[model samples]
Target: MRSTSSFFHFLIQKCNRKTRRKLKFSKELLVVDSTKIIVGIGQLPWAPLKGTRAGVKLNVAFHPSVGQPHRVIQSTGNHHDFRSSEELFDAAIINVADRAYAKCKRFDEYV
Candidate 1:
């Protein structure tokens, strides 16, 4: 936990040092998005939002270059982004997110 910055730096540095197998263009940066799954109110009563509304959300950040998931978070749908967002990286690896995330309170820190 204390070495978050160093860990991120080391990852980027290692990625940069990897040997390229062929002549092509690739993005080393990452992209992020969120999705939701609706669950029956009876199954997930803790996330209730009136009537039968209840669900959970998944936030993911992935590396475009290697097609690998770099970070992920899951939380009750009622809590929203602010409550579920975790620090994905310490390096500013050109994260591309939608405008909704751009306006979030903790979005600036990642960049």
Candidate 2:
């Protein structure tokens, strides 16, 4: 447990330093979005879409300053974009999302 935490701490510092060299900002920013990947129904029977198709949704939390995704969540393509949002945001970080993730209830919760 201790080793894992230390490793992540080291990783964060490295990313922050790289980000600082590119852009200066007071708070960390996270860009959140989701995309659907279509597959043959036979490939993944669990994630069914329309006829003959199966799909999965990849929810990505990207750190533009670092030019990489900080977190990723996967679910059935039928899942709504907002479903993964609850886990994508941190109170200390400024999270930016598209219209699909904008929910009045979620905004209130964040406030």
Which prediction has the highest TM-score against the true structure? 2
Best by lDDT: 2
Off by over 4 Å in 2: 1-25
Q: Which segments of candidate 1 are over 4 A away from where they belong?
A: 1-27, 82-86, 104-111
The sequence of per-residue lDDT tens digits that candidate 1 reaches over residues 2-97 is: 485475545544444243233232535666667787878999898876588788888778775665788988878765654434465325565656
Tens digits of lDDT, candidate 2, 3-71: 844754454565565675587756887778787999999999999999999999999888866778988
Residue 75, candidate 2: C-alpha displacement in angstroms: 0.6
TM-scores, all models, native as reference: 0.61, 0.72
Structure candidate 2, residue pairs in collision: none
Model 1 TM-score? Answer: 0.61
Task: Please give the CA lDDT of all the candidate structures.
Answer: 0.63, 0.81
